[model samples]
Target: MATFATSEQLLVIIDPAARQTDGESVRIAKDVLSAGAATKVCLPDGPEEFARALGRRGSRRPVVIGDDRALVRAVTVLHRARELAGCALSVVPVGDTALAESLGVPRGAVAAARAVLDGSERRLDLLVDDSDGVVLGGLGIPPEPVRAAAPEPVTAAAGRTWYRSLVRTLAPGRPRLPAVPSPGPSRLRVEVDGAAVVDLGQPVEAVSVAPGTGGLARVEVRPLSVGAEATPVRACGQTVTVIGADFRYRADAAVSGPVRRRTWRVAEGAWGLTLPTGS
Candidate 1:
């Protein structure tokens, strides 16, 4: 674990979303941070400028003042540039903070900004996909159920509403596998560290994977059943792969995919986060 030095120089990148969503919070964070340390602030207008700001960050510590998406975007940029290991990341929660709080950062502008100035840096695990994307929280297959709840007559509209509800329940928290979706199943092949956990012959209600201890990932697959609830098959491994008909997944707070196959490998302690001392 790397230790952060007090009074370290900072490169503060305030995401546009943060500014738009909660200008007051953003202002408070800025005021507190600038008052304590030598800080350089960058206000990027869009994704391209955001990436550019991070790419050019030299020796200063990068502190993101934004929501969960902004935090993810910062990490993604640093990871892709191969510079993630060199610096500790800091975030001041603005707008959505589920992912930040889950990772142990203090909530609110004053508290989080204080963390930026006085916190310690701790290494954390993350998932890196074959496509170079990263997952800081849980990943859920299908994101939501595609089937209607049993006991209720199935209808296209009902299925949509039910699925949306299912997705909402899997809110971000400490990185862990998400719960199986309610009742609907899709055919998929799931493998962990090269061993098959489930195959295409069996339909699955849902699949989830998240970073786990010892540089591995926790995987769970809920197989479809007829008259009874199917027990979720679970596994832990350094790598997880999923394949089948075009499938979508929710990683952290973002929903992505429709791809036939995707593989994720655990990168243990791949990044550092600034948190309260002794956290």
Candidate 2:
């Protein structure tokens, strides 16, 4: 791992969409860091520029100024560059609440910036998809309806309020689709560490497996049913596989693939990230 000096220079990548929301606010963050005399800021206009900026991140730490998606983009770029293991990431969230709150980043851009200025870095586990892309949070099956809804530019607070209202409204109703009959499982085969765990043709709603510390894999299988509770599938192993009908899956807040099957492996302590203190 690369060691950074206490007075190391820093690069700031501000998502273009976020710049439109409040460019001045982003400027404020930049000015704050400049005044601190402990960092330097680089604002990128798009993903291409973002990648270029990160390619040159060097020993200077990176601070992302945008939403969860922005954070994901930064991590993806660093991971692709094979620098994630050594780089510490910071985020000033300007978008959706689900991901940021779950990751323990503050909502206000200024507060998040402050945290970045004073925060300690720690190693965190990241989920890697079949494509070898890293996801900073948990993955989920059956993409949530809200995810597909078109996003409108709204303040962070307003967006959170709207999302909470929508969740409350949808929580009480049965899913729009008919529930798969009991024991009416779909054909899915699962394996862990090259061992056949579940190989059957039955009704299966979703299957999730989490790689734990020390090469352990936690596996959980849920049957397709109306109002089935979503729970963690715990496992500790290096590898996991799932085969089933084509379905959409979400990694972090980004959606990917409608593949017939997919596989994931744990790359332990793959990235350094900053989370809220005491979290």
Candidate 3:
């Protein structure tokens, strides 16, 4: 008679980032996982190998041992193959994990690996874009600005401007220097679930969209120059479309676009993630 307790089997894909950073953490996770499961490990150097590693995942649960971006990459691969819905994914975050934190994945290699061994699967909603891009956590319109390019090493004109300022310090009759122009609010035509919420003529302070339960994305638009009491417009819908001048948005950890238009629709319970029990 077979006396060994049945052990779960897992294919652990160790991302390049995990191998490069916190090697000890990765080792701990590997040790714990090996002890609990029948393990097959794939150390991929880049995205191509990563996808291939997952593609060859046969009869084994796929587990990712990297940070948030690694999780997104795995999801995208399975998504493109249309296999995500049937496959459950587990992640052991080992790098900057803003995405993991937002998705409620427990931190620490040991705990996360344990979750992989003992946790249950939870089906979650997703936002799929027109470009076939996937948004795991959420997306922001007109992403936080990048640091401006270094000023032209103080040239003659700038020196003259400084001289003018010094002269003004000695004389009250000098004209004040011109101020640098700040950016104005963005102009976008926002639509939700076939209803137009804001038009192009209306400038917006900010835009945010996040996945919600039951196949919907929570859409919010902050209008520019509204009264102090005017709150942002918030609604839930299945589709969100934005049209305007070229703009960019931050999705997960990456920034995309300067495109004229973008649309996202919800796919309900599109994928399953392994989460700690009672979590």
What TM-score fits each model?
0.85, 0.75, 0.83
TM-score of 1: 0.85
Give the root-mean-square deviation of each candidate in angstroms: 9.6, 7.3, 13.7
Model 3 misplaced regions, further than 4 Å: 1-6, 145-184, 226-230
Worst 10 residues of 1 by lDDT: 145-154
Question: For residues 119-140, could you state the per-residue lDDT of candidate 2 as single tens digits?
Answer: 6676766667678777666665
Cα lDDT over the full model 3: 0.83
lDDT of each: 0.85, 0.66, 0.83
Runs in model 2 deviating more than 4 A are 1-6, 22-25, 147-186, 209-218, 225-234, 276-278
Q: Model 3, 189-261: lDDT tens per residue?
A: 9999989989899898788999999999999998886667457899899999999898778787677878899
- Compared with the true structure, model 2 gives a TM-score of 0.75
lDDT of 2: 0.66
Candidate 1: pairs in clash = none
Best by TM-score: 1
